[model samples]
Target: MVVCFVCGNMTAGSNVTQLFSRSQRTQQTPFFPFLEYHDPAPGASPMGDDWSVDACFVCDALLAQQWESFERGRMPIGKRLYWLKRPSGCEIRQPVSQIELEEILNEHSRGNLDDYSDDEGGKSPESKPQDPPDDTPRLICYSCGKSDKDCPSMCPVHCKPSYEQLRTGVPYYPTVLDTDKSPGSKVVCESITFLCIGCLPKFPPEWHAVQKDFLRQESTQSVLPRIPLPEVVSCYTCGTDVST
Candidate 1:
């Protein structure tokens, strides 16, 4: 059994059954559309029955609901969080802690969240500032650099957890895309980006490419430097075969 990415529990009950059935609708189901890369090889065998993810049943259910809410404009898409029942049956929506959130925002705004997470643990003690209290004024949205209060009522997906994200968070994995490489090439982000369900397709489809370098562009942020590709053949850590 795979652990759910959001609630960190084994997906149980009807959630598992329904998710598995939906996956069966296609040989290789597209659960995370934004992360999709690597076109199927010429005459590659169709994928068999396999439905795997790290989200619990409850969290998956919430994600399904959020997709509908986003399409209908009933809720701010990826900008907000939703409540979920953990495996222990606790109902909650957990956001990044204020201190952690500040660190994330600062690092990402500097275009180096991935670098920081890679080379060190957050910021240095002297560099780290005190987190703002709950009542503090909001910063501009990371994607648009506009105040949600002043801007039109559009979904606000921040680079990191802002006050609004604390109220309406969702789980996401970090990834990078190579807009400059040959078709069907991309790289997983060295940094993690926790995103809400509705923001899955947030990136422009035209921008992704399968390439040797890792590239990324968020909302309106300028693209970061290209990262070198990882070794193919077999991942020494995960033992999964990787082909280029």
Candidate 2:
């Protein structure tokens, strides 16, 4: 039985003839009769009624190809079952042939493959080569350098010592640095530190919060307790100490 693609209804054979006639007459109009038609009842399968359904055979074939491609992957059994449910439409009177489907699939696949090949051809030298490693190491702040060891630091003004001091709790002055020194070389450096609390690129804001919380917890645990006094000694009148 042919299914009506538009309304997904089980159309009678007579209705199919009527629709075909209407479609032929309305060919010049902007509206496609198939898209406009809808089934009156919901959840009705279109297999029982024989009707000429309106559908783009090419589009249907492509959709089938897409489904087949995805099915080959490690999809869950439940998902595969769910996707197997056919559309609630009458069976297509003139469905797309396997030969036509194959032709369209090949054409599309070739175009896509060509596009991918072109993209790969346009890649930069760094992305293409997988051989010898570049020995150049990036210098970053001593505090932030532990995790992001290879990232270049914005600390051109201060050397490792100054950078360490600033991270340890010292307030940094941007204008006082003579030259920036690193694993590379020593050069005259301006000590301008613009630490953006909001625009941190390397570490996410949440990570910083987590790190701060950890540090606070560690500090609370590491604090030394004050020693208790054994006795109090005081003299009011003579200003001399007396043990009690």
Candidate 3:
């Protein structure tokens, strides 16, 4: 199900999608669809890094106006538009004025922006937990987006990855519970591991056997530890160039 990030109006239908340049051409008549937000990598195509957001048609139009007014000719829809700052010198990474959008849509569209809302049947909303504002990279539960702040007792579980990726980068992340701890059998001394919160109870049991087969395919694979372990073999003599 697609949900409008601004007004919180969700629909069962697929979202509308169009190119960035095309939307620029139809400035006054921007396509009103559930747009997807993307922060293009640095040095992407020209104008690719412009700040954009995923919003419904109504919200997108509002965002477009705000963007064009502030940026003159640019529409803040699918780019990294700005690096907002606060009075105390703390930087804020607000992609757009989401609060204003909520206020505007409160009287127009479905303004049920609460992600944790429940239905009349007492069922929880399908919305996923939103990430906290602090952007510092850290391990989080793969199932639920909980961090050490909430799920302090997380476990480390490795998920099997393509034979190629296994050669590089540590895939270990924190999982909230032990059930979501481990996935496939150990492959390549180190591969991608999942840190879920009991969300996967024997979830990828199929991978257990698949990884076993990987063992046969390759006998020896290098292990790349995410955190370096204490040196097992160090120079016995201080700064020795040759062993005597």
TM-score per prediction, in order, is 0.20, 0.24, 0.18
At residue 45, candidate 3 shows an lDDT of 24
User: Which numbered prediction scores highest in lDDT against the true structure?
Assistant: 3
**What lDDT score goes with residue 143 in model 2?**
30
Candidate 3 positional error at 211, Å: 6.5
Worst 10 residues of 2 by lDDT: 28-37
The RMSD (Cα, Å) of candidate 3 is 22.1
Tell me which of candidates 1 and 3 scores higher on TM-score: 1
Over 111-201, each residue of candidate 2 has an lDDT whose tens digit, in order, gives 3344333355746436565778766544334233322234433443232235454465433333222323223432344333322222234
lDDT, candidate 3, 1-244, per-residue tens: 4444334454343562222322333244332222223332222221223323333465555555654564444333333243221123223234367765343323212322232234555476578988889854355655655655666665555554444434443232222233333333222345444344554453443234445567569567798878755545456777544423
Please say which candidate is ahead in lDDT: 2 or 3: 3
Candidates by lDDT, descending order? 3, 1, 2
